[model samples]
Target: MNHSRAILTLAWREILRFLRQRNRVIGAVGQPVLFWLLFGAGLESTFRLGESGQSFRDYYFPGSFMLILLFTAIFTSISIIEDRKEGFLQSVLVSPVPRWGIVLGKVLGGTTLALLQGLLFLSFLFFTEMRPGLFEIGQLIFLAGIAAFGMTSLGFVLAWRLDSTQGFHAIMNLLLMPMWLLSGAFFPIPSLENGSFLLHWIMRCNPMSYAVSGVRQQMDGSFLTADLAADYWFPSLSLCWAVTILFSLLMFSWAWKTSSRRVQGDLR
Candidate 1:
């Protein structure tokens, strides 16, 4: 294997597979947008942010955006399980290509898919009350890129050990669903002063919480306000950025290491 060439070919193969299966595009992006609409309609009257004065829709939009990236990541990374069963993974393992090349190829493919879907979701922002300007959109995409890589790496690591799609789904639901819900994506966490102590602490520890919080701050009227740090409800913007970056690095390292391990059914 010409190392870099093999990596590019594998990454392109993933992209081509995604493009051929158009339903994944809908399944990944449509489901989240639909859920956003339904949830916003149902919760708008009841779910107001304390001092921020943001509506339920405004609060949910960034989380929903995060959902788009996550859904795409999940959809993209699950292919690892499928590839293994089809014997493609075993074939690749027996090839001369380095494990890191394979990891990078898969991760890059997943990252691109998530970023594209996220950008698609961002397009619908014009229809909403919250407006992120060009520069803000750039910032949001930057954050989304980091988040997508981390999440795809996580999904990649999880899927690497599984043999069936059903098994992957079950594990992902058990892990990711709680990760999203408790991460302050579905509901706001009370400030430390007001004190929902345990709940607040969990959200504080969840890395996804920082991802959603960062997006929330960027979209929550910072464009119009003179103050950049308006909402004190969640973690600070800088802290969110730092945590998000750190989480991505950790997940990437894990996935790269996991790539070298012998998965079940690997050829001797």
Candidate 2:
């Protein structure tokens, strides 16, 4: 089998599957934009007084965009579970393509979906906010690309062992909510006076925190004007991206190896 050709074919199939379900694409991209347009604007009065003092629209717009990417990653993983349930995954496993290639294609396909949705969200944001220049637009797109890959990688890891869509949804909800909340996407971590030392520490350690901070800094107004060091923000997000990708590789490799071993054992 031509490995690259098989991967391209599989990835194309996945993209077409997503595209055919036009509602999924629309809902995936539209919800976040609607949230930022309605709820974020309504909350603008509240978030404006926080450390960054950004209008809620500006503050939530990027985070809202992040949520769109996040949801797309999680939702796309559901397709994997659905395939497994329908024996589609087993069929793919019997194909001539290498297991690693199959995994890579799925990850890339999902990342592409997430990035497309992010672009749509960012377009809305750009139209609504007048101050962001070409550089800021570029920066946001760059950040969104990194984040979609990171989140898709993470989702691919979580989907590796799941056999049912319900199981995937259960696990995703368990993992996703805390990650969103502790990440400081909604509001900046104020100070120890507001929480216990451990809670504060967890927020500091949350990878989503790094993603949000990197994105927030690139907004029309820097989310906070305290003059965050570029060194700090850039490295933190890079680390988050690295960590997400590393975990994904580890997970995919494990799944591929385990499945291959199972096949070999069955042959015996």
- What is the overall TM-score of model 2 with all chains considered together? 0.81
Q: Highest TM-score, which number?
A: 1
* Estimated TM-score for each candidate: 0.92, 0.81
Off by over 4 Å in 2: 49-52, 127-130, 191-195, 227-268
What is the model-wide C-alpha lDDT for candidate 2?
0.68
User: How does residue 209 of candidate 2 score in lDDT?
Assistant: 73
Which residue ranges in model 1 land beyond 4 Å of their true spot? 221-232
Q: Candidate 1's C-alpha lDDT?
A: 0.83
lDDT of 2 by residue, 1-268 (tens): 5688777776677789998999988778877878878977688676563454457677676678778888897788777766766667777878887877877777678878888888777767655443667886677677666666667767766676666678777887798867876676765554555556776677777767766666665655444444333212223445644654454455556645544543221222
Q: What shift in Å separates residue 45 of candidate 1 from its native position after superposition?
A: 1.7
Clashes of each: 0, 0
Candidate 1 lDDT by residue in tens digits, 1-268 = 4698888888888889999999999999999899899998999898766544667787788888899888889878889988987888888888898888888889888988999998888877776778767787778789889988899989999988877889888987899988888877888665666657887788789999999988877775452232212332567788988999999989989998998888665752
